[model samples]
Target: MVALHRFVVLTTTLLLTSLAWGETSNPYLPRARLLLEELRYAEAARALDQARAQPGNARDTLLEILELQGVVAGMLQQPAKARTAFQTLLVLAPDYRLKGDYAPRVVTPFFEAKGWVGDKGAALRLEALPTSGADNLLTVQVKPDVLNLGRSVRFHQREAGAGWSEQEQPLTEGKASVARKATRVEWWAELLDERRAVLTSLGSDTSPLGALAPGAISATPAPLPAPAPVSPLPGKQPQVARAPGLPLRTVAYVSLGLAVGAGATGGFLGVRSNQDRARVVGAPVDEAGLTVGLTQREAFALDARARSQARWANILFGVAGAAAIAGGTLWVLGAPVNVSATPAGVVVGGAFP
Candidate 1:
């Protein structure tokens, strides 16, 4: 009787121990919920595995499992996994929402997944503006939200019969921009996954660039080459008269001189400003003990003068630098020189008009 009683007590203790361990560590649905509530995402995910192992879970139980799994995956920054879980949940329950105030970060992925799965979610739009003028750059903008944060949207140009080929630019962060030779082709965009499969399309902008023939660009025609010099008609010396259009060398030299002068002046002004600052700093210390150094009014005047001179010096330097560069480029390349002759004389000129 004593032995039997002892055996019963031992079994009871063992059973209680097992139950307590299961409550703390087993990945049951209830335990997973508790883990998730405590923000133990990894533990909750592990608990979810246990729940998943059980076959034929109720529809409500499955919904809860998927929602919790998505939440945990999102919290762990596993977007793909979170998206998968949410999509599966959407398949089961078309209208499912988490109870209480969850973060937008976690909730956003759910909505994105919902949009991907069904038609009852947020809508995304694409807007593209092709730049006018000489540059062949295209600017694509997307709204109102980027579906996938880091994934790129492939820009595609449609060909006549060969279908669509990816364009040069990839849109990321809801914007796409690139400089390329413009063509008479239709362009569109698509969001793609890692496998290069199209997830969804961001649509296209079909603004016509006028009715120009394919491969034709509108550009000013080149001026006809100047008539070759006529063979000298026996004995009349060529009377060459040159028309000067702002001598490039002269302009370059003058601009360079001004630049050098302005730079020197700026440097001098900077030194003076530094000197004034030093004086202002020292003035306070020297004047600390009853009557000494610069007066407050004098220090203020010096500071103001220093700032004004510095500002003017910077402006002069910038203007001088720009002028020098422009003039120097013209001088190096040399402008088109045109020459024409009348019966009385020959005239040499720069640019026709």
Candidate 2:
């Protein structure tokens, strides 16, 4: 009986230790909350610091921590610190609101931070305008301009199946140009501070803007060769002779058919990718900062699958663009022409090669 009791006590001790360790591993945020409720403003501020130092905190977690840090600083009469915390939070989430009922001290600084952000126009936004004609240039405009911000815009671009390449440009003129050299291009822009930290962004790595280069239909056709010099005989009028080019009508039709099929497949895959991405984005997180209803491995697998499908969709779209260009070029080159001698002059029918 003594031995059994000792074993039971040891097991209970070990179990409690394990639970305590698990809680402490991610307890900073919750501890800060409790400290705030108990009016331990200084201790809550320290807890918020620890929480921020912890890596891999979710966006929601960071937001909560920032708000709490701002409140604690305000309660402690640190106006500058409180304003800094609130400003960082506002930059990350422009529409974020303070949840609980706070004293005028806390609310006052938060609103002041809002006004500072507005005055500085710190809300960075990027907009991609549509290209016209056969221009292969993509124009990205920065909202409110960054010339006075003492910051630069960084652009991340990549072709399908290729790694990302970054380009940093100072938006002195409020806009930058990206050359579209590939069939499918993925790109996103970020507003970077002096320390190269991201302040705000338009798109992200997982969700990038895609653009297709203009096809051959928008390109100017090559000029045809000058007609051979006609020889005039004593009694026979000058006659022009031309040999029919290889029949490309059939080949062009086949290429167009393939393009249609590939385009349809790409569209279907893109839809599936978006659906999977939505599911991953909408997954709920529990108090322990873990995704609910799905294991971590399952969530990772879903994300990987979504990325794979998106890549494949981009590849198919590229293939479709190439095929369509080929078909259009062939159709233009193979168009037949009819020539007839008339009293007025020689008349030509059909499209000019």
Per-residue lDDT of candidate 2, residues 1-353 (tens digit): 99999889766754564354233344577667766877998888898898877754544666777888998997887778999899887766666778766654566567667556655767656778788888887667766532343266677889988999988776556776767757678988776545444556668889999877777343457899999987554454444543353567778899999999999999999899878766655566557443356544554566567767877988999999999999988877776666756555777766656
lDDT of 1 at 212: 28
Candidate 2 residue pairs in clash (backbone atoms < 3 Å): none
User: Using TM-score as the measure, which candidate wins?
Assistant: 2
Q: All candidates' TM-scores?
A: 0.28, 0.40
User: Once superposed on the true structure, which residue ranges of model 1 sit more than 4 Å away at CA?
Assistant: 1-27, 119-353
Per-model C-alpha lDDT, please?
Answer: 0.60, 0.71
Specify the highest-lDDT model's number: 2
Please identify model 2 stretches exceeding 4 Å from their true place: 1-31, 53-61, 127-181, 189-198, 204-207, 214-353
Give candidate 2's whole-model lDDT: 0.71
lDDT of 1 by residue, 1-353 (tens): 99999889766755564454333222377767767767999998998978865643543566677788888887887768988888867654555766534543355556557556444343444566656666565566655443352144567654344455665345566677654333554566654434333334545445322222334656858789999877776555555544354575567677778778877877787678667655544443223232245554564466567556667767877876887787677566455576666566776666543
